[model samples]
Target chain A: MKTTTVFTIGRQFGSGGRSVGRRLAEKLEIPFYDRELIALAAKESGLSETLFENADEKATSSLFYSMVMGTYPLGGGAIAGRSEMPLNDQLFLIQSKTIHALAEKGSCVIVGRCADYVLRDLPNVLNIFIHARMPERIKRAIENYGEDEKKAESVCIKKDKQRANFYNYYSDRKWDQSETYDLTLDSGVLGLEGSVDLIIAYDEMFRKTEGKKRMVST
Target chain B: MKTTTVFTIGRQFGSGGRSVGRRLAEKLEIPFYDRELIALAAKESGLSETLFENADEKATSSLFYSMVMGTYPLGGGAIAGRSEMPLNDQLFLIQSKTIHALAEKGSCVIVGRCADYVLRDLPNVLNIFIHARMPERIKRAIENYGEDEKKAESVCIKKDKQRANFYNYYSDRKWDQSETYDLTLDSGVLGLEGSVDLIIAYDEMFRKTEGKKRMVST
Candidate 1:
């Protein structure tokens, strides 16, 4: 069987990044996992959805992550209760496992959750980042949430910052830095459909390039 | 007679900012000046156009600007052969005079060269900064110049840096900072016509708000 390809999308909030990803997945006949990942991870871990949802796309908590990493058992032997494991760590473990499971299952488009880092070593993976200008983001936020202009603008900045911090903490990369991704699209310029088209076109090119490499290697 | 409102645009090169401004001016039945600002400034100063053009939108080299006001002179005496003024100083003077002249003359859209800072104190002036995401800017540069993709990408970064430096050196605010303008829109998101529509809407709001203020005062 041909190896399935997974696409991970990192995006600025309100940039229609999710919409683009959804359309791309539909057009390419791949599964699209977004908030659904949290549910699946929760089910897999037998944990409440909120625990996974709260820690979704976020790195291990800074207050305790360093402490745990420093003192926790490098091998097995857990000391005690669930609280000792740290909420973020449990969430991360479940999410990491779920990502591997999903990739093993089939090709999919994963939005956020630092999936790019979780599956970085995978051969048939493509990572993409999406961003738009402040005005464009604000406009989209207003349209999406019926927010007042000022509130919409604030939400746009806050969401992007959260996403950036999440990506940066988990990955060996500066989120939105543009260098690490297989492709980065400004959804503001292309809009949702256009962005989807661009990604599809890029995927075709990438596959062709990979095929050429395989032929050379063999 | 009513004072004419001029829309001054500051832009990164290869962003199609100039095209947006020119098209906007045409739609509004107003003059749009980019390169023409240099010629006009040169005509006004009786100096060679190259002097003004070379110094365009760069930091002012004069000691006064470097040490103090952080702006070029609007209307002033140029001491001939004064050890050759610094590049920044020449740029400052040219930008200042060019901005003031355009404002004093009538309604016009002056593209780039710090027209925003030069006419900040003036009434009925609209200043806009145009920007796009790295990918979009790179695409535009590649399409417009028929250059290699990598080369176009580098040019986009270089031009944005130049504009950012130029704007920062002269203005207290960041170049693309939304607070500096009455309205900020991403031309790439709104597209050319949408951008023009946004500006017109803002202009209408400005007049209505000003009218209300006048009524309240009386």
Candidate 2:
């Protein structure tokens, strides 16, 4: 039987990471999850999709409170004291649970929602971080997202900070920290297509090593 | 005329980054500078080579003082107040100058000595950071470097921290920070050969983009 490999991507805003992940999933013939994750989490947790969307990759004021009380959730489960958790924390737990379920179901590509941290224990998972230089990112924002040329730089910076805050608050690891990921690619240098190709190459090499390790263990 | 593209590698101890740089230089038919950079710097600055060897990638006590005074060097030249600088700072300036001179000469693979930071202004430079899992690094330290099994982990950690301190002190950027680099690869995942391949691939794509920009500008 063939083993499955799940890919989790954390990306900077306007870095083309989402496009890369989506294209990679298509190339690999796997399911891709991004904003689709919010709907899944909502359905699984019996929560409103809008709630997840609103709080998506945005840290809440109760972050400090949750951190102080150590109320973050890990793994898929119904927590004993989950009722007292903030809505943001509750949503995060639900999303994490959804990510866990998705990974268990089959090979897939998951973007953001701290999927890398969620699937940290799985040996079959590869975590990637995608970033680009500020100028290129700003240009991408302006071109792809139709962001205003004058405000695009600040918009990109703000979105990255929001993602970082959300990831840092929810996970034990910091966002965009190189050590936390198996590979970090500069989309500005590689371009979206090149990034996808490199990722596929890396994944192929990665699976071969994993196969050897599994054979040795078994 | 063909353009020169310098590659600067920053690495954790036991990551086989030195070997990777040397091998990459050989594959590309270019000069590889590691400890040889020390000799070049010594000759250029008329400083003792031992002084550079002693201060190599080891932050000095005056790091904070130099930071506060804004005495760090960036380009290839003698500073106005160079004589008054600490020995470590003087060595760093000399080394930075040597790096600048080497890069100016032709394409080369330079390992450590803050080559990435020194050559930051150059459009033809690719900055890479290589790291590996601690266990793998520890194992490599023991098997390859003849480090004692028990002390390998701490030795790796110490060397990495020393390099980080030196990089952080001399450059505007923090060591191992993902955004500071064009690419960061996990040797634990890709291994040395895979890393070298990925870098060459990225470099080819990067140069194509650079070539386009140059054509547009000219």
Candidate 3:
């Protein structure tokens, strides 16, 4: 607890990764960031919440591209060609900076936002990925997102693709790869509460060895 | 489990994945198969244990080439060009049959051997991939394998490559990709026991939901 620790969760769509991360943050008595990251980035960069929300977790979507390129507010004033930058890229930069700031403050669980890749250099950082079988994820999507079975299935694939593209675009490593993470668990099998318990118990080992530099990480 | 279930683990070298898998099998009161698989295949196929061991978990390596092929026992009879088959390929066929037989018998935990891909048709199977960061894996390699720091790191890479190549050559999917697995966990952060506990807890949920077939799986 003495050392600053950051838990970054990378997850599949409808996998309850965000919920489990929030529960883990609460159990650890640390701050949790999910959608609040968007708001923070919006505030920090003088960008509108709508822009952040539209660009949130989406990569190179035609809807966002057509509507957000030059139509959205560019804040109070901007340098030339600022509008030329892709909306997703701009939003991602702001959120990445916000994630770094939040990580520096103290211990926290930051969900999505490519937080794992952003903070990969830190020894105190633990990157966890939560995923589940297709059927389980579809069930969660139906229960939580109020989508019907067919819609849930399609939406799940689309959303995960967006997240993968978004993460892959910004990070050096491939998104959702097990090697890129410290721990990967199936939320479908463990459920949200069960996942929280596993993370807490696992993080204890990390807490004990946090400050000790095991070896030079390349 | 009310109905039979098989837990298949795919792991990186020196990641404690094999140890954790053995512990999980013990905790679940199920059979554990690792090197024992090679022994079983040798017995079932009338091949020498040494032949199986030499070809065990190994990919197409020229270093192991010329030494195993056609030199080992081809059993009591010859099936014409049977000796022409690479020793690793022969071992793999026997091991694959052994894995299928083990899964059919009852619940068990089978490590490596591409059991995940081999049993893809089974609804009662769970495929898990275990990996850890390079530094943690390197430290484990040094402590467990008695290799120096540099040797440990290099050995880690080589072993993982062999495992990956073996899995990829035998299985339909890539070895360690997250999508190929039902779950992936880091034993480095969780330690062997912690990893076992997590698997057990996660499998408990699976036990409850399994055998019921939430939907008709084709």
The best candidate in terms of TM-score: 2
Model 2, CA-based lDDT: 0.80
Q: Per-prediction RMSD in angstroms?
A: 10.8, 5.6, 5.0
Q: On a 0 to 1 DockQ scale, where is model 1?
A: 0.04
Worst 10 residues of 3 chain B by lDDT: B209-218
DockQ order, best first, reads: 2, 3, 1
Going through the candidates in order, their DockQ values are: 0.04, 0.34, 0.31
lDDT of 1 by residue, B130-213 (tens): 655456667778888787886987787777777778788877667754434433444443455655655655454444333111
Per-residue lDDT tens digits for candidate 2, residues A1-218, read 23688999999998889999999999999999999999988888766677789889877675645753474442333445665666678788878988999999989999998998888777788889998877778888999999999999999989989999999988877898787788888776657887898888777777776431211110
Instruction: Give the poorly placed runs of model 3, Cα more than 4 Å off.
Output: A1-5, A22-31, A59-88, A104-107, A121-124, A142-154, A208-216, B1-7, B22-32, B58-90, B101-109, B119-126, B139-155, B193-218
- Chain B TM-scores across candidates: 0.80, 0.86, 0.86
TM-score of 2: 0.84
DockQ of 3: 0.31
Error of 2 at B215 (Å): 15
Per-prediction tally of clashes: 7, 0, 0
| Model 3 / residue B193 / CA error / Å | 4.8
